[model samples]
Target: MRIDAHHHVWQIARGDYGWRTPQLAPIYRDFGVEDLAPLLAAAGIGGTILVQAAPSEAETDFLLQVAAASETIRGVVGWTDFDAPDAAARIDELAEQPLLVGLRPMVQDLADDDWLLRPHLAAPLAAMARHGLVFDALVLPRHLPRLIRLCRRHPELAVVLDHCAKPPLKGGDLSSWRADIAELAQSPNVVCKISGLATEAAPGWTVADLRRAVDHVRDCYGAARLLWGSDWPVVNLAGDYALWFAAADALFADLADAERAAVFGGNAARVYLRRRGRGGSRR
Candidate 1:
């Protein structure tokens, strides 16, 4: 039941990836399930939650198609026009597909730091709450205050923070991010993903470079509220899948067996997959 709760797949030919430029050469090419299956196999990962790479309904539909075809993809965190007038209807339509486990509005890429607290997004968020969809917050540290407010505003919505809010590991400052993370964790409804940290560190970062942040997240959220993810291809920007996975394993090696299972797989299943009865096969 080992689950890599956050990862992505994209076809560069689709032209929707504005961020996938030549500068990110390590992962700029097309990456589908075929590219990831062996990596998951070698890591003993049984399933993954395929997430959206582009901010388009078409891309969401594309991810749904990929999830529908792949057994290993246990769930999908697709995109939708959360501010659209018809957002509720759009969410209802997507929810009919069953494999659509959650929705993510690329909040990190948006310029407004308080975008999560915008008045207009309330109705759409209510729609998501009604549909039992998780809100994957793709945010940065600056967005955390608004995120805390949003969680307080919608206590029913299951929100998960992606990439530890893209911490400033490279900047060597954990004080601010640590304080904010503790505040956000106060909400019983919010959870944090232990993924994508390596990519935020200094080039060729060792596991030691990631220890403080990882340890802090564990201390704040504990095993029950934490989940593991690979962030895959994007992880290639800092290191490869094997490197990050090994680092994560070493970081949590001291936990008791049950707690370790919850962090690595059970929490993701209970948060994302079990709600949809989409429990996938074990490796």
Candidate 2:
């Protein structure tokens, strides 16, 4: 099945999404599976990995509930307080949800560039590694180095890097970002997602504008390690679902059919849903 490896469902009334303020008027309201269903159908997508938008365990539970009722939601990447004293137990409990395939910490919004390296995170991360869960990294360029270090620290952890570390497409100079991405890709356990780039680029970005970054990532991670995602409503901030999907399709036109399939669905299945038993780390 062709899976949208990354996308989100949120309810404004949930009140946990502090980032969902009045200023971001485009997606300021609730968006559920019903809202995204048609878009997925039009794109010929069979399933999706429903990702978390808020930092609360309530939101994570909310996402798992949504996935439980939906046929198209193949998996869910939820969130929890990674530093909580009982984080390992919390992870064990969340892993009990059959549809819950992964967890994310929303690392991009944090003030500290090295937050992933904190000593307290060790047990929680190790717990996640123990479960057959994927670690969905929501990070930016500055966090890549620390992320690389974290990957080394937990070599058994199955990690999927969200948005190719969300490169600064708005910034013309990507030399540093490129270097970091290349270095991070060296870790065998790390996989990269080709999602959220449109939101990171200048408004009205086209295939040409995204080509260089996409090409660079393709070169570094190759098709086997790369996964495609819509980034959906957040994608609406720059362009709509069809636009980003078509753009990604066009950008990867040169790849072989099998390779393209890997990016769109196969890789995601392998990373997030393949071995869903205890200690299901991909590497």
Candidate 3:
């Protein structure tokens, strides 16, 4: 099963994602499994991991409920107040929902630079670590210092760095970002996602533009610690679904079919350890 390791589900009424501008109005529509089936089907993508986008635990519960009803959604990366006084109990409750696979802090908007290592966040992060939950580090270039500090402090928490640490491909300043990413990839507890480059590139970016960052991640993380994600609607900001996927497909098409499958889906299965009869991806 070709699994999309990252995607988001949200409702306008639930809580507004202030980032959703009128420019992103197309995605503002409701996108449930019903809307996703065709996209997944067309791409031969079998299952996906539904990640959290809202700021509330209520959104996590809602995603879990949706995953429960759909075979296409094989896993979920939900959000939680890791600093909450009842964090352990809350995680225990989330674990009961079977498909709940991980957690994300929406790290991009966190107010304080040191928030990741603050005393309040420790208990929640530790709780997730105890439960063997992978935490997706959603960060931008500015947050790398703190992110690195947190990973160094909690070597046990498995983290998948979203968007190759969100490089600025369009700006063409790859020096510092690549260095930081290489440093981060050295950690055995972390993995990198070769996804979301389209959104960060020049509006007309093609296969070659993606090659730089893709090559960086492929070189740094290797096949084993790398996963693939669509970052769908967000990718739409730069190009359509087929257009975005075609870039990676082009870059890896020269490799053997097995290697191609590893980037598309196999890496995610190995990282998340999905159940039997679910994945058809090659390692």
Candidate 4:
């Protein structure tokens, strides 16, 4: 069962996506399941995890509603105010929805690099651990140390680092990002997603431009700890889904069949779906 573990669906008219400005004209409009289903079909993608684009709980509910209607969406990574005093209760409430598998705070957009290490987040994170909800760390390279500290504090929480911590692909420097990724990988509780890199690269990026970063992640996390994600409409900002998917395929082509299966789908099932089985026989 193949899963595109990270992607988003948003409606512009909803007025929740603060980041969706005119500058992002390529993907500034509404992107619903209707727009994505065909692409999934063409790629032979069996299932997907519909992730949060907006930080509003209303948007999370909207994503949950979409997941409920779309057979292709196997799980959802929703968002909420992690710093809210009632966050634990909120997470417990959201956990009632069986498809709600994870939560993500927009850490990358925050001004503070140590935001994840804030004391107030402990309770909410503990509640997430108790509810079996994964924490998708939407972070940048600079934020990785604090994330590592958070992982250490809550050893049981399942944390997946999104987008290889949004590495400096465009700037062409991996030294800091590489060291931080390696440090974070030391925590068995943390996993990394091989997604969103296409958008981080300069326009007209070749597969070679991405090879080193991909290889570095593979070395740090291994097949079992790494998962593949399309990042969908956001990926359209730098390259199309087909192009990114093909690039990922070529990059991991040297892996053994079982390792390939784990990176492509199995690890996502294990990490996000919390399922030991291979994700319901691929939709």
Error of 2 at 131 (Å): 0.9
The sequence of per-residue lDDT tens digits that candidate 1 reaches over residues 157-198 is: 999999999889986677888999999999999999999999
TM-score of 1: 0.97
Q: Give the least accurate 10-residue stretch of model 3, judged by summed lDDT.
A: 274-283
**Backbone N/Cα/C clashes per model:** 0, 0, 2, 0
Clashing pairs in 3: 1-279, 1-280
lDDT of 3 at 74: 75
Question: How does each model score on TM-score?
Answer: 0.97, 0.96, 0.92, 0.97
Please report the TM-score between candidate 4 and the true structure.
0.97
- What's the residue-level lDDT of 91 in candidate 2? 92
In candidate 2, what are the lDDT values of residues 185-258, reduced to their tens digit?
Answer: 89999999999999989987889889889999999999999999999889989989999999999999999999
lDDT by residue (tens digit), candidate 4, 36-83: 988988888888999999989999999999988888899999998988
State the TM-score for model 3: 0.92
Q: After superposition, how far is residue 102 of candidate 4 from its true place, in Å?
A: 0.1
lDDT-wise, the better of 2 and 3 is 2
Candidate 3 structure quality by residue, lDDT tens digits, 1-283? 6778888776776665676756786677666778677888888998788888876888888988888888778788988887678987898777666677788888788787667768777777777787767788889887777788788888988888998878988876888888888888778888988777888898798888888888888888887777888887677678777887777778777777787788788888876654332343221
